[model samples]
Target: MTVKNATAVRLAEILQTKRLENPIGNALLESAARGDLRMDALQRLVGTEAQAHRAELAAYGTMLARYPEHPAADLFIQLAQLVYAAQPKLRECAKALGMSDAHSSRWPAERATYSFNGTLSWLAVQGSQAACALASYTDMKVYFSGCTQFAQRVRTDGIDVPPEFLAYYDDEGSEELRQLALDVVQNGLDRGDDEADAVFCARLLEESIGEFWQSAAGTI
Candidate 1:
């Protein structure tokens, strides 16, 4: 059954009114029953999503603060800021590299905001950012080496980015990696129940991102 998009509370009320059989909805109700629902993410999930840049930056900060030594911790911190930069430049780079227009459409400019509580939404909006973010966390020496190279590129290439971030745009095999990253992100988001526990999404985020870092390392 397609879950019509709604905030957690609204989704719960609708599920109750319709007596729907959604596991997520049921979980939300259970959380509410236990008075442990994370109403912040749910309430902040809609209308307020335009805060994508702020929200993602804050998320990275929260995660880094929460888990600073987790191999990919610095990667996450850098990638969040990278997403903001890559969000604007992704499509143009995709076009320049002669990638399929179908993929190019996915990286459109106006669609570069975060999608809250929706796996599909996150998949769509942050797809390109996801690709680049994953690339930065590769444990492989070569891929990990690219992180420094990207920083160099950021400095020499000088595309209006800050002086500190080591953001990179790898036209080489980026499309495939991006698609893979998006798929992994989709999997994590799909498994997580945001309506129930807001922290679960964040947790799945760390796990999914950590998975990419490990995969990048293994592929070396």
Candidate 2:
């Protein structure tokens, strides 16, 4: 394989291993699949997600500013647009789980849950575009799978809310987004971004994501 392709493949392999080892994601998916996740816990998950998306939107902006002329700038722009477009749906999902606007606004922030955002923001400001893109891909890999399963189970179980609330999660463009990120990583490699640094950033982001899931699981 070419160096860029090899790097992407290696990153994916490492991230997949970590993703499978994430107990919290597994538990949450299994609980939702079994229709055993409590309403309050699900509410908390949605509320937390809303907050995280807001942070993600801003972080993408920061990344765009930092990489204005780079190919990764397009990835940042697309991500921000996706996050903005998905907010209304996410709020509707929150309401379906009995969270009022006021209630969601009043939800207490968990340190562990926000850790991923903190790391993401830090990367946006100080890390390479490749690092940020790779990290985001690692994080999204698990989240997208969970969301797809959740939407499916919600429909199968006849949940009150429209499954379309999660329609953005499994967006038809999701694979495109992945390709954009991988392309950005390849560009970064061509420009001499340190492979080890990119891998470490992805690992760090993945760990923070695990912390978020662990904190969310605790709410259940």
Candidate 3:
């Protein structure tokens, strides 16, 4: 999809060769070992930049784990959105969600059932539980961009794939969207995050899928 620059390509190659336990965390050392990432990019990456490199984030996560009271730890978590393992609110919310039966009583349906509170709670539960699921700082933007692109297609061209109908934005009230939301409901605070991803897929397919699904809740 995206063509990497020469240096970026080389960096990937170097990273692959390291075969390190924490790949992103070791990127800087690996690149420096291979002498590819240098100068401005290197300084910005290793030093401190608004957008943290994967390795930097990894290192920060590690440091926070070792020393949570390290002054700016909270700032890092808030700014970088590296709440993959942040505590307190996420911990408490996840615990409460865990107490519930999760998917034991519910199964994903063929149409979405919107619950703004439920969805927000689910995001926290999933996001907090699955550390490293979102690998980068900009990962959220990447997700939003993907959904926005598809939303545009539905809004302008009215694209609607049949059967699987992943792009059935116009027909988000379809069974597929409901099915996705159902999966989220069923998965509930499970260890993995695919179900959480499904929630977004349904939500983004039609911005109003939640509302529409909510409006029709219990009818179907």
Candidate 4:
């Protein structure tokens, strides 16, 4: 069955709240936060060097293109829909926080970037492709851990990031989120659908990654 907008939002909210409470969740969230902070700082320093970052995103996108129906892909698609549905409220949140979409022009781009990274990591672990798996896992570990640092930067630098914007990286109380993610992954594994799932997730990642890069370049 296709994932509905309401179901997606509920899943996201549940995952976030549940996942944040676990140690693994904390580690992953913190890592991602750090990466985000670094990206933000890099953007500030280099101004719009979108080309430099394109290669990394491209590599990631390619990896994700391998798994369209993966649990990660399902999660991302849900996230994209939820974010789109919440645009009105999200915009309001951005306005209240005095944040501009200048850094991340569209919600889809933000969702793609965040979800792609996680999916890449998950695929690496599940896929038997030695080289890609190693690289993706390494990148995933670093990205998740970096999230904490990014959150810190937002607080310290007085970055006007809205809560909704932060929600993508918010692992503050996400035990349920972790459980949901785990359930998806385990189910795929148990059903021996891991390979198929990876391919599905990969395809979604590839498309969204390209879209994100295009949006960033166009913005520049």
Candidate 5:
């Protein structure tokens, strides 16, 4: 079935009506897209995202252990692997932004910057498979969009980042992962998971993501 028919999609549409995009988050992306973002702010963005990648791996591992026999377990495995592989590329992004090991090691990770990861971990332990899948998928769409835009605009302005790092954010393989998430949502509904729970989780995850963006914007 098409992802459009997924219950998560329908519920997400309704959820979208109840809230708006965070303006500060929008401004952050706009600043990056215009290639006008401050250097320190850009470093913070990469550093925070790198921290998130590590946190996501932990969350996925927890979900895998929590729901071993479920199909969503495979999604968790794939997500963990995907994030692990992306780490080297993100390190390259940090390097290109002039964030060396010494520089980044001194960067303190903010608790507020990790609200999304914290929420995901909580969902892994306390929420349903549908909630985890739907909320994760929603957050992934936003995160991936921001990465793609950042790469494109930075490259357009002749930034020194590696092409491989920029190429990693391309549209090549994301659709399949998205389909997997949608399939998990479908399986979830078939097994009597609560649709409202999924929607609520999505709301919480999205808000945390928005907060991350807003915090990043404030640094600029």
Candidate 6:
């Protein structure tokens, strides 16, 4: 289905809203938040793979050294901070949902280390952001799919999750969110920014996945 412009913007807002209420979703959103900035930065530079790789590697090295303890978690947290700082509206929405900024910091740490390959594979096929903007339009599709599944589960099980809380994964009337994501992807692609942003976002995502591996290994 073709997404409308107004709906596209609304989807972005809904995605933002979902992130605020769901810790797991927030962690994924944090990666996209950081990836967005990295994409913006990379777009301004001119270089082939070798040159860009050297620069990005150096930056990653610095990041690794500076955040020796839970580097990936730290990076995600930082990204969350940036999003919270820049998007007060999101903060307010989250607050109304009874979640706090502290949840963002603790959530990533609570999960067991996940496989980089597995997470990337899932994210590549599912989830949102510049990385999976086009391809199969899988980013938002995966999310909506998940939301639908969760809703079904709730209906069948009659779980006790609050209605407001359900907003995190609700897409009952979210045609707008889906449309917004498509618009963002199309706009990014049309401007050639999509390719660059996708690449950068992918790298950042890979790094986080690697960090998860490291975190798991360290515990072992």
Q: Give the candidate number with the greatest TM-score.
A: 2
Q: Model 6 compared with the native: what TM-score?
A: 0.33
lDDT digits (tens) for residues 136-175 of candidate 4? 3223333334444556656776766657556644334334
lDDT for each residue of candidate 1 in 1-220, tens digit (9 for 90 to 100): 7432223324224323432342212222233335554433222211122233344555555544544543335455555666466544433433343433322232212221222213322432343332223322221222233344433443453434422122223323244433333333333334443333332333333333332222222211
- Model 1's TM-score against the true structure: 0.25
**TM-scores of all candidate predictions against the true structure:** 0.25, 0.83, 0.21, 0.34, 0.81, 0.33
Q: Which parts of model 5 are misplaced by more than 4 Å?
A: 1-5, 15-24, 32-36, 101-108, 155-173
lDDT score of residue 90 within candidate 3: 27
| lDDT by residue for model 5 (63-170), tens | 888767657887888889988887777677666656674224624366667776688888888878888888867777667776677667776777666554565554
Off by over 4 Å in 4: 1-89, 97-148, 157-173, 194-220
Clashes of 6: 3
- lDDT tens readout by residue for model 3, 21-136: 42222222333335453333211211121111223345435534532432224433542343333223222322333322212222223233323223332333343312222221
Give, for candidate 4, the lowest lDDT window spanning 10 residues.
Answer: 43-52
Ranking by TM-score: 2, 5, 4, 6, 1, 3
Error of model 5, residue 218, in angstroms:
3.9
Against the reference, the lDDT scores of all candidates come to 0.34, 0.72, 0.30, 0.39, 0.70, 0.37
Q: What is residue 183's positional error in candidate 2, in angstroms?
A: 0.4
Q: Which of 3 and 4 is ahead in lDDT?
A: 4
lDDT score for candidate 4 against the true structure: 0.39
Error of 2 at 46 (Å): 1.1
lDDT of 6 by residue, 1-220 (tens): 7545443344344544544573233232333334332221111111111122222333434433433344232432343343344334333434544545422333223233333324344544443333443321333344345445545555565555545435534554345434433555545444444354454444444444334423322321
- By the TM-score metric, which is better: model 4 or model 6? 4
Instruction: Encode model 2's per-residue lDDT on 37-81: one tens digit a residue.
Output: 765556666666776886798899999998876678888998899
Poorest 10 consecutive residues of model 2 by lDDT?
164-173
User: What order do candidates take by lDDT, descending?
Assistant: 2, 5, 4, 6, 1, 3
